[model samples]
Target: MKTILVIEDDIGIQKQLKWSLSEFELVFAQDRQSALTQLRRYEPDVVTLDLGLPPDEANATEGLACLNDILNFNPNCKVIVITGNTDNSHALKAIALGAYDYYQKPIDADVLNVTLNRAFKLAQLEAENRALRSSNVAAQEIIGNSDAMIKACRTVEKIAPTEITTLLLGESGTGKEVFARAIHKQSPRVKKPFVAINCASIPENLLESELFGYERGAFTGANKTTLGKIECANGGTLLLDEIGDMPLSLQAKMLRFLQERVIERIGGRQEIEVDVRVICATHRNLSEMVAEQSFREDLYYRISEITLVIPPLRDRGHDIIVIAKALLHRFNDEFNSKIQGFSDCAMQAMMQHSWPGNIRELQNKLKSAVILADSKQISAEDLGLTAQSSKTATLRMVREQAESQAIRHAHSLASGNLSKTADILGVTRPTLYALIEKYKLLDLRTTESETQQ
Candidate 1:
């Protein structure tokens, strides 16, 4: 139960408050001196202060001083000042001095209880946000110590404080968004919104409206005007994920907007100017797409004034174990499990296997392992690593899987346009055709006729 301190000089009033607020652990104080003592002792989340105190029932000087002292000691503690019915001036002054809310001479128990509950909830939310924020600060940069990883970190740290348009290149699940967040957190615009939109996630038809919002009555369901992601992130950072997947038609419009720094809603004619730091990320190679004319060369250059390529997880030798240990401890707390660490066999499996799915795959695997682990330590079996999986994946197998998945992802991003898919994969028409046939990636085909092209 949360503690509440009541500072009322009247004996009858104190009895009445204690009886009414039976839900909380109530501490009574009749004077400023006693209230301060209780405050220092209990460190209560809330306090109800009566402006009328002992030795000066005619004035609010003592009560006001006590309120100031309470606030001075703990800025986060929520304090409610009780005032006379006609003393609106004192109540307003109390608020100006950081009092949470004020109650008048006639305090209704139910009304006061509502305010107290709200204050407690607000305090709890603020505390959680602070905790989460601190963890975010600790995880501000990518966690890796390898040379390639260090190079990526240095590039991000070097470019974060600037307004330069940057492109993050890497395979899927390699933490491009994490790197983007690190950049935004370190940028001048850190105080502003860090809006992110996945181009590949949203439908091709609605993607335009989502990027640049629609006006009221623009569509059948457009009941109210809406601000797009770009406008919402004004004076902040905007991340366009899977930009290579952005449809061919939308690419031209996006290019125009980037060039002008202004956007017009789907049905709105007026161009709304935006001041956002645009960051683009994709597992697909844009330069190859540019060569094949699927992605506009101009747009690629505009977004990639600087580029940072995150190394694949398999290549970051020792960093895998480092990240895995940190994840184990975090998951331990989250699952309320006492998993000591990885078993020797589990560690061997982790180090040997090619992390095809990268960090995302690793995180999911660990999450399941933590949940399923019966012993203090997690075994390779806990991670679902079979005998075959524990064996090191061959270089050929790794290359084939990576290449096939990359092609399939590009096809999905391009919406099964073979021309665009070939462009995104940086392969000629013949090579892309051969890879698709070789991998049986026809599941990505939109229509059978298109595959023939």
Candidate 2:
């Protein structure tokens, strides 16, 4: 049972309160000092305080002090102040001091009971909401700042309202499932279930049964009546991941269900109506599969009412940096590491390299780098990227390399004509003279008459 602490100086009032609040384990205190002691001892969920307490029953100073102390000890604790009917100003002051509520004497039992119950229910609801918010943050863990990702968010916003079937087309590891969940979260059916089934993961023989379920004694292992994924996702969404891998025969049945909004269990003669919004995803080119006569054309049309193309990570500008920071936070929590962040060289290397497997490849590399990194920050070598060697190894060596290459290339291409070389390179005559001065290519810079054919 919830505990309640009462701080009232009157012995008669304490007796009445204790008897009235019999539903809870009530603790009584006659003064501010005793009330604070009981508060810490019991850690009660609620408290009732009478402003008339010892040391000065005429003033509400002691009660107000106790209320502040109780709240400081446990911010979630609810405290109700009992004041005289005429002392409306003091009641308002008590409220501003963070009392949960106020009661004016003579207190009505029914009114106080309603107030207490409301406080308890509010606390319970707040706890539940906090838990739900934490779960939402956990589910939305994927992060990126690319233009493609921004467009994807917009597409989600547009299609989440209507009851249209969506097809997510992307390469493997390009986060098709993440986008699918995002769609479901934004849809009208967010409160309902979102069932995801991979067509390619299950064997061909069992795929139909998995999608459509089976009746009792339908097969050797079918001991009881079972509902299919479509039925399970009624009033919500069903994600058919890798739909391109579904068998040709089952594809026809899936199309029938999409059209008719009904399904039949395996070895059952009854047609059960189902309400489900279908969302499909596949990495393969469905058009080619249709041309090859492997996939049904009718099914493709049913699933692709709205198509979303997710660009691979390589094409998304500056997304590498955004993704790196998110992955760092994730790995830090996962491995219990105190690593600060990525090094400058590491960021440059990530920008330079091509992420062939897209986001999945980046995730794997960061995981390894986090585990193997000796210093607080991850460096380019930790990520196994080779530093560019052609740049400045030294200043004089760089100048010599630059001059020798420029002179030889210009001499070879121009064949001893300075004006022709400058014209061919699209450089101004004076700029060409600067190069000739710097590289000491004066021999190549013969007179203009010598340059003429």
Worst ten in a row by lDDT for model 1: 386-395
Whose lDDT is greatest here? 1
Give every collision pair in model 1. none
TM-score for each of the candidates:
0.56, 0.57
Model 2 accuracy (lDDT, Cα) = 0.81
Residues 1-453, candidate 1, lDDT per residue (tens digit)?
889999988888888888888899899898999999999999998999998777877888888899889987897788999887495978766775667778886768877887799779767754643453355431345675567866676677789888899999999989999999989988889999999999999999899999999999999999999999999999999999999999898988998888899999877989889999999999998989999898988899999999989889999886787678668878989999877566657777788778899999899999999999887677889987743453224445666788988987887788778888899888898888788778887665545366566
lDDT scores in order: 0.83, 0.81
What TM-score does structure 1 among the candidates reach? 0.56
